[model samples]
Target chain A: MSALVTGATGFLGRRLVRLLREDGLQVTCLVRPSSDIEPLRQAVGDALWSGVDVRTVELMDENGCREALLGCSVVYHLAAGLSGSTSTLFLNSVIPTRRLMAASVSAGVQRFVLVSSLGVYGTQTLPPGTVLDERSPVDPHPHLRDPYTFSKVVQERVAWDAYKASGLPLVVVRPGVIIGPGRGVLSSRVGLRLGPLMVRMGGGQQLPYTYVDNCAAAVRQAGLAERAEGQVFNVVDDDLPTAKELLRLCRKAGAGVKSAWVPRPLVQPLAGAYEWYHHWSRGQLPGVITRYRTAAMWKPLQYVNDKAKAGLPWRPEVPFDEAFRRSLTIAPAIG
Target chain B: MTTSPSDMIRVALVGCGQIADAHLQEIRKIPSAETVAVCDVHQDFADQAAARFEVPRAFDDMQRMLSEASPDVVHLTTPAHTHCRLATELLQAGVHVYVEKPFTVDVREAEAVLEAAHAEDRSVCLGHDQLFDPSWVQCRAMVQAGAVGDVTHVESVLGYPFSGQFGRQVATDRNHWVRKLPGGLFQNTISHPLYRITEFLTDDRPALHANWFAGSADVSIPTELVAHFRGEQVTGNLLFSTRIEPQRITRVYGTHGALEVDLDAQLVRRSRQNRLPGAFEKLEMPLRHCREATGNLCRNVWRFLKSDIHYFAGMRCLFEEFYASVRSGSPPPIPYEGMLRVTRLMEAMFEQCREREEAGDTAPRHSQERIKVESDHTIKSDQRSNQRPVTTNRDESRELQEAWS
Candidate 1:
């Protein structure tokens, strides 16, 4: 079987490409013109690579997207803009996904897999006695006004809407903050900076997390399994601990950092003051306090991934603590 | 019977250990107070202290001492495990109570004392004296003023071998307070410096996540203790031990620079370029208000008596606040809410320790039964054969790193 994958150079996308290739499928990776191919090469070792922009490629007019989709029986769309201006989310995620779905339909691709985010469930401070599952309502807080989450939500909605209207086989995978060996934002920025001194946000009880390899495995399972069609899975592992426990894991993994909880009330004013200063100074303000306070990364958001497990036959390969430790050694290829 | 200002604060010394001497000396220095009575679990010890300090009253029973002396404040210098029970009973009897560190072995008991204090409308204070240290207070003020731009991290270590003088009672008891405390050194000793350090850095209280291993529990000493504490904008590690030989250090890393304190030497080091001329020199000088007096007591005593004074002052402050609240309808400074938060943290540490032990990763090293030899000839042969030569320094260092890695 032939498969076409977008974002094949990305952390998750690269992993997916390898898994599909290992499964004996002819994988064609759609890469950006500018993405460094070294890591992807390291990951997939000379898989058939295609360089093209999905939106600009006159896929329908010149049949470029359709051509890529032609021989491929399955289409895996994983690429999405993580951050930019608010409007960029709509343009980058929603539009491109719609275009890809349309192109897949025209090319008669048998199955479609779309990678979404647990962020689409939005910023959840899961109440005591309740755990979030796929059926839980998405938070309406406008995705933290973050382009990454906004784009993800739009992307999922587009895939869902298109699948409903066109009766196409679609599987949407929403993975909690993806963490793995040298992948994901937390591993890249947060893990590297962790050490003996780390200020834990608010008693570090709130849960905000993901593991990369586990999420990738879930995505791969969804792509291959017929049971995953028409399903949306929240991919997370068990033994999810409070933020404080996560920090302890980081410390054990040699991050050796301290975690302190800052009271919200004290930091809230500092955030407001930072925003005001930024506005008054025309964005000259450093916004350190404001950035720390506004970023609700420490808040609890528990997700249940039983649906993914039950349907996709997926299980997390690495435990959370082991994955966290491995994340420290994952050096990103800096361009 | 209204008393003059000179006799207003009558004090009783409870648990006459090494710390009680410091408290008695401080009381001698305070003009309005006198140590009317001394109590110890051992009658001889109480008699010795009463005679040495020229006190009129001494008792083995705490209740007898409290009733006869009618002390306005009771200085609790007992082991941490007993602080809650004694403090609760004393507070309920309308005596302002001061308890030593660890405040209580458990939070629930600490809460019970606070509840009792509330019911009786009396004052209670924990002996966390590092909070009042001038250097710490100064450091706190600077961080609050943005001296080290947005204090992000703090590291504290209060590590040392078990004191040479910890005594036979502690040595013999397997489940003694020192050996069995939730976090061992992290609680019994490091908590003093940790609480003080956090109090200085942020107004926000921290949630603690600790991973501890039994470093030398086999040697009948507590192991290397490490804890990570997180606040909203700050994170810190508290590393402590009763095995590592005499080391006291604390470092606070901020965005711009770092501030470190060496408690043993009483030195404060700042990483920033321009510093005050006498800042380091001033730290070398002994602490001045040792016994609540206005003048320099550091020179007279060569040691600060207020270490105990500071310890007892917490109780005094707790009592003064409680008395004011009862008389004028106000709240105490060391409020129950604050104590509750501290208790929760204490409970978490205990839970983490129990969890680690249950996982079998932190089993006591000394729990293994020693093999008995049939005779001296057999014992000598076994000792000689079993003695593996110690690795040279270079190989030892490499092996240590590899083990940790």
Candidate 2:
């Protein structure tokens, strides 16, 4: 069997490709024309790399993308623009997807799996103690949203739109905050670094973060399982750790440094000041206070994966504590 | 190495450490520069370097390589402390020299190297190659072209990645060579930004002020520093740290506008004064920055796609310039006076630090005692020599202006 995968250069895409290869499927990776493949080569190992084929196309090139997807059985649409303004987000994420999905359909791909984000729920803050499942209502149009969330929201709608209109077998996998290795598991810069400290906000609010490998596994499951077709899945770890607990675990597993907590009220002000300073000084004080993710930072994110658990033969492989510990160490080589 | 053309420059690299690869890789590009020999104190390192670079000769002994290879120039890639002695030896042997930065261990050693360079009547270039970095070159040109109008103040920062293998080694290993330098790791690494900043200010004896914070108990070194340099015309700030993620940035502020030069991203972001009202600036400034950042992103991505970016590109440019000066009898790429002045500035800063320690100001609080914040004036204020020669080097009438793109 042959599988076509987009975003093969991303965090989850690398692992998903590895998983697909291990399953004895020939993998074709649809990479951006200008994307560096050295990282992909490093991620997928040289010895067993013969089974994988990487094709480069400008995302806007519909025919090129369609040609790359040709003769492949399954398609995994995992590529996303991480951050951008509204127009850029629409241009990079939405338009590319609308194009790629059209190409996937034209190529008669077996299954189209869309890797979306839990942010589509905008469940960043629900009523206190409210749990969210796949069927729960989502904000039709999320407001005051970060470009990432807004883009993911719009991208998911596009995927579902294609599914309803074109009868394309699509599965939407919405993953929570992915905590992975400090280096090389996903994005080169993403991961839990051994910083001198892990500063937590919102006084130990519950956070819906998933271990990266587990999230990758869930995504892989969503792609392969027939029952996952035309359905939505919320992928997260079994237990959502509180911000304080996460920080404590990070300090223990990470640089073994001090842990500090800024109260909920103060976080907003800090973020506001940081925003003003960032604009006024042009990032002279970077990563100091961060963007006004005050709402996301302050509110508790409680995601329920019951639908995914019932539908797919997958469970959270790594628990919260183990995931936290593994994030601090070098990721084990998995075949 | 193959037989060279009459104008071909035969180069031998001494000290086959990590940096030697950069030199070897870059030397392959220049048609006239042929790397004839590789040398290191360790025989295995010499052999490995020679095989790696496909050079004709490898030797554990520098003298043996110099005599046998008879190269036009010897690149001194050894530890900073060893630079003075080795450079002097090569210069005395009537060979042109290029030493990696910290040019030498301290002021005295730099002076000795300077004297040797003059005595041999040979060119000696310090590897402050960021001088030729396209980004910095563009930045300096902008300053000259009044892009940032009358450069009033400049700040340059050097950040080390202490979380990686090399960084972890530097953090844990107290016996590392960097820890043994006069100013410890700062003396070893600060030369990068210090020289970059010195290029603009051109003051021989700039006033120095510095504050440091201990990184951690395990590191056993003060890994964070903020140093200010007040000059004749430009006020400068130097931020040095091993705490932050590895970054090199130089921001120049002027009366009309300001520009931030990012070495990592390889771009310059020029910011003009926002003419909007105070309340509206909150909205407009961010939008303006977004415009500049996005514009730079598109440009840099295009450049990258065109294969315009290369690691050690600055090193390659400097090597070319150094070889050019060697081929011609032009003044050296890095003037001897600027080299010595950088060293003197470093020495002066360390001198004040020592004076503070002797003054019984131990356990200085971060809030209270910013010990070496010198406000009055320069060291050797009245009797400053080496000023004119370096100032002339910084003038617009240099040969380096033409080499820049």
Per-residue C-alpha lDDT of model 2 across residues A48-158, encoded as one tens digit per residue: 599999997766679998888878988888888775334345556777898898998888887888998876774444564577778766545443455566667777877
**lDDT at B226 for candidate 1?**
65
CAPRI band for model 2 = incorrect
Q: Which number leads on lDDT?
A: 2
Question: Candidate 1 on B205-277: residue-level lDDT in tens?
Answer: 4776665665643455445666777788878787766666676677878888777765554545566543436
**For residue B14, what is the lDDT in candidate 2?**
94
Per-residue alpha-carbon lDDT of candidate 1 for residues A1-335, written as tens digits (9 for 90 to 100):
87888887798887787787778887777654445667776776654333221222421132567766777888888877665433333434665677778888887788899988776763444553356678876645543334466557656766878888997799888877776665522321122133544554544343435576677778888878876689888887877766556666655656545445556454456567767865444333332344432543434445576787788988887876676666776635210
Over 4 Å off in model 1, which ranges? Answer: A1-335, B1-3, B167-175, B180-186, B200-207, B273-335, B362-405
Candidate 1's error at A201, in angstroms?
63
**Measured against the native two-chain assembly using Cα atoms, what DockQ does each of the candidate structures obtain, in the order listed?**
0.00, 0.01
Clashes of each: 29, 1
